[model samples]
Target: MNFKELHNQKTPLLLGNVWDVPSAKTAEKLGFQAIGTSSSAIAALLGYQDGEQMGFSELIYFVKQIVTNTNLPLSVDLESGYSRDPIIIAEHIKELVALGVVGINIEDSIVKDERILLNGEKFASTLIDVINVLSKENIDVFINVRTDTFLLKHSDVIEETKKRIKLYENAGANGIFTPCIENESDIREIVNCTSLPINVMCMPNLPDFNTLSSLGVQRISMGNFLFDTMYSQLERITKDIIDQRSFQSIF
Candidate 1:
């Protein structure tokens, strides 16, 4: 089945979020149904902050490497498409498509000194322009429109998220991704509000896979948690090796 079709399954499609070739390869070896890049994780790997600090070309190179080294269907976290211009975003999408990517998560928020949500209506319009450009070229991509309402903890978040869901769906989005949505009630309400597959990121309080499927979450993402967890373990192992004056951690 195709990448998009994976979301239509009765249970949620768990995306193994990877940062590099090793991570992607690991996901594949573990029998993950699919994999996607973690923009924050990738940026951190390159000694940069998240939110498009890494250049689009750099992202392309890294994605190309992962695609070349793996057989699984891959999606990318475009992180606002690396440009405000919708046409440029479409061009970026085209480049990823050429590299064998099947889906993308493009968010509606941008980072200044801190994160902030873009005007939902305006962002939806941008999605329209971006999708239009891709359509003209006959390119098909799973445009998983990522909205930051829950992540930013906006007041009236659920209502605002449902509103953005409609706007994004109307703008030709194939799915809706709202990071930091951990509540079962919110997930069910959001899923009830739209036909688009709802994607939730890994949060401290996020429900288990069975609960998520029961709530009608069509997709689940690890975001950057796996990358963080792996490195955190490595740091601990190094400390243990230093204290013992032996490379015991290697075993």
Candidate 2:
């Protein structure tokens, strides 16, 4: 199935990301129409760090596994497309498409300064080339261009967010992802920028389902939150065991 077509919905497709085959099946059984793979969660599962830990070959294997286990259209988190070279990144995009991924989340948040950094003009330049290359491949790969400005820099967050969206749209991004925005006004500004779908991180204490739906957010991702929650829960239980305290089911 062409995954981008799924996003052309009256209500945005709410994708639940899975790290492994079982998780993908579980999500599929839970009535989620589409399933995504989390790069963080998958990397943690394989005992590696995120971003280029596993090369395209290994990533292709994982995507194939996810596809084999379930029939849902898969959207993969190809962390920074696994390379800096736009040609290599484009090749990786084609590899993912060959592996049956219907969508991909490519981000400009290159790891630097111990946080996400946005090289606005450079990333935009690369994105245009990447999209152009993929178009030649003749696959309608859904590109959810991720912008990490809000998560990294807070100064004039609204203006920076708009700038990134404009650049991404010009680069042919199917949608725009602003990972963590604090307030509703900022979300509104992004919503007003372009008609393309806007994506947000699903923070527990932040916007509720109704609020997100009202804000015109077409996509909401859990990112590493689910993986972090798993780690925290396991650590808490292990600590309780060491302390001889009753580990009641907190799940």
Candidate 3:
């Protein structure tokens, strides 16, 4: 099934976000329907900070590797498309489409020295331009528009999120992602306000899969949680080896 059909399934589409070929293969082997890249995880692997610190070429090369190694439809977390100019962003996306990527997540936050979100209307306009370009090129990539209202804890988050979702949907967004939103009531409100499928990132405080599905969440992404957990395990194993002077942890 295509990524769009996966999102429209009765059960929520659970994405295991991966950083490399091995991780992508593992996710597929374990029966995930699709593979999504975690930009933070990829940035760490490339020895750079997230938020576009990793070069676009480096990111694309890494994505090419994953796509080459796996048959699952891949969606990339292209943080702000790596540029503000819509044309440049569309060029990056077009290259990804050529590389066999099926979808992407683009956020509205500006992640420079300080993390400031773009104005809702302006971001919507940017989405419109990018979508127009993709359409003109006959690319069928899913555009998941991410708004960081809850993640950034913006004031009047619910209302602001509703406004942004409305504008983004009108701009041709395929899905709406609002990460860090754990409250059931708020999720229900947002889901009710928009016809576009809702995607939520995994958080400790978030409800379980059944509850989220009932709340109208069509997609659930692990984001960097899997990568972060893997590294934490590595740290623990290294400390164990140092303390006991043994390689038993590896075994």
- Global lDDT of each candidate: 0.94, 0.81, 0.94
The TM-score values for the models, in the order shown, are 0.99, 0.90, 0.98
Please report how far candidate 3 places residue 235 from its true position, in Å. 0.6
Number of colliding residue pairs in each model: 0, 0, 0
Tell how far residue 168 is off in model 3, in angstroms: 0.3
Extract clashing residue pairs from model 2: none
Instruction: Please give, for residues 1-251, the per-residue lDDT of candidate 1 as tens digits.
Output: 99999999989999999989999999999999999999999999899998888999989889999999999999999999899899899999999999999999999999989988989999999999999999999998999999999999999998999999999999999999999999888889999999999999999999999999999999999999989999999999999999999997889
Over 4 Å off, model 1: none
Order the candidates by TM-score, highest first.
1, 3, 2
Q: What's model 3's lDDT at 169? A: 98
Q: How do all the candidates rank in terms of lDDT, highest first?
A: 1, 3, 2
- Which ten residues in a row are the worst by lDDT in model 2? 109-118
Over the full model, what C-alpha lDDT does candidate 2 score relative to the true structure? 0.81
